[model samples]
Target: METKFLVSLMFLQAIINGVNLLRPPDQHGSKCSKNGDLNSNVLLKSRDVALDELYKSFRLPFTGAQRSNNGGIWAHALCPPKEKMEECRECVKDTIDFLKKDCPKQKEGATWSIFPHFYCMVRYADHPNQGNLAEWAWVQFNAPPGPGNATAGELEKAWNNLANTIMEKATEVKNLERYGYGSVLYGPHPQNLYGTMHCAPIIYQM
Candidate 1:
């Protein structure tokens, strides 16, 4: 029974996360996407220098978590600016810890999470990978029953619109900076929603 309750809670959280899908979502893929763990790819593969630079960039300018590694890597964790940085840190830290539980071989993956704030991203890779890859990253959409007359037509339109925006913004970020998008609706109750996609901006250069 407890397990059932916990599953129910998790399902609820995922729905909310999907609804607010943060700007870029997570940089990593689903556990099934690759063959190993995210850290093995992100933390282990990256060099020390890039990680240090990333750390400094996040705290000061973004007020978020940041880090980079060799092989031209960089990352900035996501969260609401209003939340205590410590809390967001803890959440992201926990996400990393949990991410370890998955993709034991793929060596690359990320999971969206929330304790406070709408969404977040975790990224790391091999090769000379850098920049905002959000546009190239896979886009996901979700729409549930709602109070308004919004139908499948409205939901599909919203999803495509969001994808198109992500494609455009990612193209414009110059293959180095960062970019993301998101939205929320209350009047529709269970209406469809919108969110941004993300990637290593360098993906655009490719």
Candidate 2:
């Protein structure tokens, strides 16, 4: 049977460092779209400028910025609230570096990265719809297999319960950051399954 996990890109969560219950989503894809007559030099220049502002926009944990008049380059960066200031900046910087290296001249690009920690995203585009929920990207990471002798049925049941708890907790608008994390017991084992979720704060503005 083909099992599918449908997660809203709004909130990123789960996949702890060592347990390997899930592999944290990381740098799914760096999409680059060319537009207009912006020469390569001008494009990179504008992108770099916008990226600088984008990085600086994170005075708070979550923020976005826009630059240029011709088509424009817009960017957004997010890191979970629990993440440290320096680490969050580092995680966001990694995404920025990925865009700079992999998507040099493209007028538009976006990337969701799990560097340092699994809770971060950085995206840039020429259009102004950075806040559009309908436009999003994702990548799913699956665990190797059920741990111990827990049957597939038992494992699936435990996973469903964990996903539901995390989804509900993640969707709560408790703060402007709009992110949450939780863990649930797995079968009769002493081990607990973990997960986390986060949505772009701007989603609320819409």
Candidate 3:
């Protein structure tokens, strides 16, 4: 019963995170075509279809990228490491809905959202492999709310150390999903800090 209750809590948290993490399109810049170009229309249509397929059938705890026929559109979706299948589905659903609303006319777009249990990413573009993190056009996020019992300098130092560790561990593994997540305790209060890093499979190959 405890396990079931925990799962229920996670689901609720995921829904809340989906809503709270959404950001404005301008903060990430617009990649959508402005001139109503015919190719852009085709690409948009294809992207929509690809996103639908991915939402319908993607493996949990992994990253998947799909391309439309004739390669006019590409889309990618990723769930947080070790996410449950149902949670992953919900995350992808939320991500798709958010993208459509936030990037209504964009030819390319991407978003990263933090859910209570995990995080998810969704992106699409007119060209293939646009989901590659190294090639992503934008990265935006507010700083962590407040320093938790630690000085600003201590928090920065801890964050840098955690980030570097995650990166090193993520890259050391040559796999389809090269990502890592872990926690560390630091400072006089020994507050626990969590971090995660990921690169799309294509990015690893490149």
Candidate 4:
């Protein structure tokens, strides 16, 4: 029992570290910006539905979210609209769904943008002409290392580099565009293959 508990704790720690290292930073919650209008009142069901509908229409290969109105600032990370659209959509959908049950009528919230990396996702109740402005939110996570790996230290370092590269490239693109942005590694079991992440700055832009 002691051994199992220790292992479980270690596994959890590794997962957390992995998330921090691979995921890029993202600001969470609705901190109204200078250009944002705090009076928008995003709690209205109609506006929420509009935001969701607009978010789903992009047809990108991944999931995305926006604050609605003002071009719906859209942003994404590694992964392309042509490749992992479903994963992207589901990711954002899952967050909102979870919050609906979890927060209950809350207007502002944020989540780990990346599935299991340093990536961050965020949105707020700033809608209905209240204005939006969370352009460059920061969300940083760190991954230490795990045991039982052929090259634990080496893989961890590589994963860190992969996460950095993906986010660095992802944020530079103009809104509305998609990036097949992601990182991978060569191996057998965890041969390390396939990664996807995205962001949407346009929707939340005030």
- The numbered model that scores best in lDDT is 2
Q: Which digits, one per residue and each the tens of the lDDT, describe model 2 over residues 58-126?
A: 564233311222225556676667756666677677778876776776656666665434446666666
lDDT of 2 at 143: 47
TM-score of 1: 0.51
Off by over 4 Å in 4: 1-47, 50-52, 55-80, 83-95, 111-122, 127-152, 172-180, 186-190
lDDT of each: 0.43, 0.57, 0.54, 0.39
How do the residues 1-206 of candidate 1 rate in per-residue lDDT, one tens digit apiece?
43233222111122332344343333333332453334544454452334334424446344333545455443334454444665656556655554445533333444555443354444444433434232323324343335466556766556556555544553464623334455444334455454544433333232
Which whole-number lDDT from 0 to 100 does residue 175 have in model 4?
Answer: 39
lDDT per residue, candidate 3, 1-206, as tens digits? 43223222121112121124444433322234343332566666776787777667765344433223234656766665555666777767777777777777766776666555456667666667443333234444553443346777877677667666666666675644565655666666676666666555562221
- In candidate 3, the residue pairs with backbone N, CA or C atoms under 3 Å apart (3 or more residues apart, or in different chains) clash, namely 32-106, 32-107
Report how far off residue 203 is in candidate 2 (Å). 5.0
**In model 3, what is the error at residue 189, expressed in angstroms?**
2.8
Pick by TM-score: 1 or 3, better one: 3
Candidate 1, after superposition: displacement of residue 196 in Å?
4.2
